[model samples]
Target chain A: MNGLKQHYAKIIVWAILLTIPYWFTYIGGYLGLANEIVIYALAAMALNFLLGFTGVLSFGHAAFFGLGAYGTALTIKFLVPSTLVGLAVGVLTATVAGMVIGALIIKRRGVYFAMATIAFGQLFFFIANRWNSVTGGDDGVGNWHRMPINLGFTTIPLFHNSLVYYYFTLLLFALAVGAMGLLLDGPFGRSLMAIRENERRARFLGINIELHVWISFVISTAICGLAGGMLALLDNFVNPRDLRFDLSGVLVVMAVMGGMRSFWGPLLGAAIFQWLREVLSSHTPNWQTYIGIVFVLVVLFFRRGILGFKLSTVKS
Target chain B: MAQLLLFDISNGLITGAFYALMALGLSMILNLSGVINFAHGGFLTLGAYFAYVLQQKIGFFGALLIAPMITALLGLLVERVLIRPLYGRDPLYSLLLTFGLAFILVDGVRIIWGPGSPPYQVPEWLTSPLSSTYFFLTGYRVFMVVLVVTAVAALFYVLNYTKLGLRIRAGTKDLETLSTLGVNTRILRNLNFGLGIYLAGLAGALAAGFLGLSPALGTALLMPSFVAIIIGGLGSLLGTLLGGLLIGVAVGLTTVFYPAASEAVIYVMLGLVLVLRPRGLLGEEGRLH
Candidate 1:
């Protein structure tokens, strides 16, 4: 019965997501906003791969995410006009960045690790901000959009049609999510969980803690880069803000709000956060305060998140 | 050429002094409470803004002294209400709470201050360069360095000579044992948080005179302090101080030859420091781990 319920949950989630493009407008969200939610959800889930699954706190994921954006943007803007190549370059860039940064901070633990990550994340932001000639600097890299996909005989116009782009993104999201789900169910993911539970015990059990963490960090960043690439494609622009620590913090908040431990929690969290941001920003200028208040409230009271809450009766 | 180098070094030291002031507060809270206090920048901004507002009524010196105290009180209150409960939980919760609070504070400042750089005036004499040959030695810069020295000295005196200081040092080393010794750790943590915030506020007030009163003022200064703490090594106040000074000089020197890489130079220094000394320059082994 439990297995059946889990199966039902997966089906329901996929069903809802598959139909979002159709019903999103009726729910006061545009297709672009839906794409954004999915992309952000992908990034948040990627962050959760480290924060929740591995029990490692990385406030620097934005560096990878931004790298993905800049990589995709710069690639398409200057290097190539192909959307697929742009995305591959974006992910590859984030992967290389993650590998280097992960190796650097592999030995640091707890808050030190988090601090190092934040500082490193800001390094990229500064680089992007200061490297104005190549990066377009603070103004952001613009005047380029995602090109159409040419599958030999057929061409899909990703630039002109938002719906086509949305489906394309959804397909990529499924592949990434599927890969993550498989990894989480496998041995490597189990080792990450062990490290999260107790590093000393995991170390005692002969698990290579640092190696596992570095790998987890790299995987999370690479996935986050994919999300960043999608974001750049969605907007056809990438800015230094993408690499800023604030976005990193926001990604962490999304994971926590949706219940980091739960596999799909960040998706729900991202959806809620994106929808609220859309609605709130339109209604009031002090939307960030409201979002911040939500953050405080979540950390204070709803830390278990929507999925984390349990309805159990206590017998006294 | 020598004069130019000297000018940059002095300028770097000035900025480094500011970083030390802020970093010392951050290191204090991290040592004692195990909280990163991301809202520290927020508090610093608040202090600067408070000074800006108070300067109108009571003048510069009066505002400078009172503004940080108000910010400290607010910090104390926040610790009691928001941070107190999160103690003994995963440090992640406190970090997140503070991170969120930073967001609120930044937005709140924007709402109140109208998102523009407010004109923060020092005395007329302070604005003028004290030496004709050394044009960079503005009276304001010298006065800022003096205040920073005085603040650091006062801080050291309090830590070394006072009972509260004794308890804070003890707590940073071993909060659990400090609590076992019946230190009323609740109050200790609260006061420690307040004291750290007080430094931030003070730094903010002084920083406003140089950087001008903008919402971004705290953020611009925030990353350098983190680098300072990292370079100095965690759990060492003196190390933090040295780290700040080192980075300031590094940045100052870089600006002379490579203006574009000036900001990036400190980070490069941080990388080199991390590689050369992982635990930080003065960080003790197994202190925070």
Candidate 2:
């Protein structure tokens, strides 16, 4: 019966997601907004890969996410205008950055590790903010947008159509989520869990702690990069704020709010947060105060998240 | 040319002292309680603003003494109410909590003061140049240095000689042992947290005299202090001091050559330290990890 319930739950979630745009339109949710929610959800989930599953706190994931956006934007603007190629560049840049930064901070643990990541993240922001000619400086990297996907004989124009773009973003989200699911269920994923549970025990069991953590960090950052690329494509613009520490903090909050210990937690957190932001910002000018209060409340009270709450209650 | 160089270097040292002062507070909190105090900057902004408020009533000298005490009192309240509950949880909780508190304090200050740089008056006695040739050597600059030195020295004296200081030092090394020895670890952490905030408050007041008072002032100083803590090693106050000074000078020197890279240089220094010495210059192995 429990197995049956779990299977039904997955199907329900998929059904809702697959038709999320339609439901949004049904309930007065904007199509463009729905698309944004999907994009941010993907990013938040990528952050959770390191935080929830791996038991690591990375306050610097925005650096990679923003790198992906810039890489894709720069590639499309200066090199090829192909959407696929732009995404490839974005992923490549973010993954490479992740590997280099991972090497530097992988040895440190806890708050020290978080601090190093923030410093490096800020370093990247400084570069982007200063390089006026190439990066457009504080004006941000714009004037380039996502191109049509060429399938040799056929093409899909995802340039400006909201519905088409939402589907395309969802497609990417599905692929990334599926891949994460596979990883979390595999031996390598289990090793991350081991590290998360107890570093000493994992090290004693012959797990190369540094190597495993490096890979996890790279994978998480790479996927975050992919989400960033998708985000740039969706908005047809990329700015430095995308890579700023505040965004990173939001991602962390999203993961924790959704329940870091469980899969799908970050996605839900993203949904609620995005929705709340939309509602509150429209209603009040002190939206930041409201959002900050929410973060505090989540930390103080709702660390288990909605999904976690459900699972625990059912078990009890 | 030499005089200019001396001026810039001296300016750098002064900036470094402020960084050391700010970072030292952050380091103290981290070393003792394992909380990063993301709101350290917020506390700093408040301290500056508190001085501004008190200056209207008590004047500069009295404000300097009272404002930090108020900030310290707030710190104690926050530690007792918010932080104490999370002592047994992951360090991440405290980090995020302080992060939320940072947002609250920053926005709260903005709401109360309006988001702008408010000109603050240093005492008239401290503004005159010490030498005609070195116009940059204002009495205020010297006073700021002397005040910082005195504060840091007093801090060290307390840490070395006082019963509370010894307990904090020992607790940083081993809370479990300290607790077992019949010491109230909770009070120890609470007092230590207050002490750190007092330093942050002091740094804020000193900083306002130079940078001017603004809601954004703390935000600018916060990251460099983190870099200082990281470069000096997370667990070592002396290392934090050295790291702050080193980066300040590096940033100062960079301004002479590559103006654009001044902010970026500290990050580069951080990366180099991470690569070459992950434990930091004074960080003990396996202490923070």
Candidate 3:
């Protein structure tokens, strides 16, 4: 019974996600929005890997995200037409940048780290915004779309069919989430939790704090980059705004809203955020105020997060 | 060629002065409160907007004098209501709260002022160049520099000479000791937050004279200020002032030789600073935590 109870949340979450495409539109959402929620959820969850588990506060995850986005978008647009190639290029771009940046700033902890990340993220934004001839600049990369996957056995018609693309994204999300779960259950994840709880004590225990943080930062950036690539694919477009600081803030809010401590919390938070954005943006031009209010309310009242709150109640 | 170099360098210095004003306020709040105050830019935008509204009522001089005080009052209320509870908690919560506050302030400005850049007028006399020989040096530019220099001098005076300043410095170094010594650390923090916002508000009012009043004005300056703080070193005010000016001049120099890389140059300096001297030029070591 105890074992089953632990897995219950996972089962229910997967069940809903697996069937979301079918039922989402009945509730006035479309397949594209479902795709967005999942993509953003992947990015938020990636951020939570560092934020929730590792105890690092990065206010600039958007740099790697945009890197991944531009890498994939540019690869497909300028280098290769293959979807898989674009993704691989995108992930590689973000991973390498992450390694260098993480190495440079891993020693700085807390708000200083956050400040550095924000500044660094803007560096990329400036590049993307100014490199107009190549990046399409403020206009962004249009006139390009995600190509279909050319599997040896059969080509997946991702470009033509929205339903097929949704499943493809879901499959990738599941793989990333699964890998993250396995990592968390290992000794490496334990080390991160220790660092989050008490850095001094963890250092005293001789856990090699900087290496762990640097690795965690790199992994988080790689995942965020993948999400950015997917976002470009989703819109068949990419812009400097995709990697802007505002998106970084939104990702952090999603993590906090869903319960950063819980693995699935960001996905839920992503759904809520996406739904709110869709609904509120249509109703009024001042929707940013409402989103801002949500951030304040969550910070004030729901810091435990929706999932975290439920878990606490269950424990009690 | 020499003339062009001088022109760009001076241009950079002027921009640097603006960045220094903004970064000094941001650095003070970060050092004392451990809150990043992402809404510093929002406060700046609010300050500019406030001056715009007040300018019609009492003219530019009165508007300039009064707007920052109003912005600082708002800052105090924000510290009391939204930020106070998160003091002992992880700095993350306060950071996020301010991040959200920034969004609200920007959007609110948009809703109230409309989404366009409103025409902002400085006194016509101030807009004119001080001399045709030095055509780039407008009276307003010179006036802004003088105001910033005075503000910095005043800030240093308060920090060095006043009771509140002493407490703020002591608190930044060791908050627990200050509080235990019956200093009322809470009031100290609130006042410090106001003082920081007051600078941001003042910068906005001064900037509006040349940059014009736009919702995005604050956001544009926000990044450079962060770079200034980082380059100046994390906990040192004098360093932030120096960092701001250095970057401003760097950008100005870049514009002369390579205009495309002008904005990118400051970031390169930031990266170099982080790699070579992570504590910043004057930042104390072991302040990383």
Candidate 4:
């Protein structure tokens, strides 16, 4: 009877998780901002892979997200007719870029590694801003068509409505989360956790510490890229501001608020952040002050994060 | 080629003056307390903003006096409140705490001042051009260089001769030992933090006319300061001075020659330094942590 009850509870949790995006759309239909929240939530989840699992604090993950968005924008403008191909290109580009940077930076640990990543990320921002012909510079890349998935026989239009795109994003997010879950449960995932816990011990135990970190970095960047591509399609435009370090700071704040150690933390954090941003910005221009204050309070008081708190309580 | 080299060297020295001021504060704090004080940049920004506000309300001289004082008080409050609890904890906790404080301070400035750059003109008395056979320099720039040099000299003297300096040096070398020797190490740490913050504020106030006060300026200066700290060798005041000069000149010359690679120049320098001397130019071995 207990086993049956456990199975039912798991099923219910899964059901709720699956229905979240749909619920977002339902809420958006009433409130008129659900689609935006979904996109931000997706980006936040990508950040979760690096911050939550690997204990790597990135201040510039937005660079990968921006690269993905730009990749998609370029693909739509020059190469691919299908949105699917564009997204694939974006993810692939981000993954390769992530791997290259990870290889170089993973040699350093702690604050040095964090600063190095930030420098590289800012370098990308500089390129994005200065390369006017290719990137559209500060004016942003616009005039792109809504992404359509070509099935060869029938073309499924994605940008006809925000609700449809939200569902498509929901499906993609679910797939990404499921893949991450599997990856985290595997031997590689265990290795990453070990490295995070004690790098010297893990190295002594015959783990290739750098390689594990590099792989995690690539996977995290690819996820961010996927979200970036989706965001470009959703917004119908991509700007240099989308790739700025300040946005990356916001992502870090969100990841922390949601609970850096939890799988769904980034998503929950992003949703709450987005909602707060919308509500607060509507009321005052100084919403960032409030956000900063909240961040300080959280850092001061909630060392374990929101989800971490829940887990500790449950364990106790 | 000789002229270019001279220009680079001169530019570097000027830039180094600013960096030395910034890095000295950072080194002092790091030595006295194990915290990196990420809010160093924020305090610098505060100093700049205070000066700008004072200049608007009173004159440049009055603003100069008031800004640094206000900044020092803010520094004391920060040490007393946010930094006190993290003393015995992991260094990472202190780092994160300061980072939080930095975010609040930066955003707070943005909230109060808005996102735009505030106007800060050089005082009329100091705005004239000063010509020399070697180079025609701006009077304001020359004044800035002189001010920085004098301040650094005075600081060196204080650190060398004063009783407070003796306590700071002893406390930095062995805090627990000093406490056992009857020194109030906690009080020393707080005073050291306050002093470091004051220097940062003073630097900011001085930089206001040169760099102009902007919300984004703190971040732009942050990396260079970190580079200076790293290169100068952790906890070595003289080393920071040399490191700042090296980076300033290297960056200035690189920008003049290959603007495209200018941004990467500092990181490249850091990489080379790490490879050749991971302990930094003047840093003692095993002091990296």
How far off is each candidate at the interface, as Cα RMSD in Å? 5.6, 4.9, 4.8, 5.6
Model 3, A4-33: lDDT tens per residue?
754998899889889999998898999999
Residue pairs clashing, model 3: none
**lDDT digits (tens) for residues A1-316 of candidate 2:** 1556657866876887788877786776788788878888899999899987887889988999999999999999999998989999999999999999998888888878887777787777878888888888899988888898778898787886667788888888999989987898899999998988888899999999889888989999999999999888888888888898778888999888888877777888898999899998999877877887887888789867766644231110
lDDT of 3 by residue, B222-282 (tens): 9999999999999999999999999999999999998878888999999899889999999
- DockQ: the better of candidates 2 and 4: 2
Model 4, first chain, TM-score of: 0.89
After the best TM-score superposition of candidate 4, give how far the Cα of residue B270 lies from its true spot, in angstroms: 4.5
Lowest lDDT sum, 10 consecutive residues, model 3 chain A, at: A307-316
What CAPRI grade goes to candidate 3?
medium
Clashing pairs in 1: none
Better of 3 and 4 by TM-score: 3
Tell me the docking grade of candidate 2. Answer: medium
- Better DockQ candidate (1, 4): 1
lDDT of 1 at B6: 93
**Cα lDDT tens digits for candidate 2, B179-248:** 9999999999999999999998998888888888888778778888999999998788989999999988
TM-score of 2: 0.96
Report the C-alpha lDDT of model 4 over A151-185, residue by residue, as the tens digit. Answer: 78986668786556767887887788778878987
What lDDT is obtained when candidate 3 is compared to the true structure?
0.90
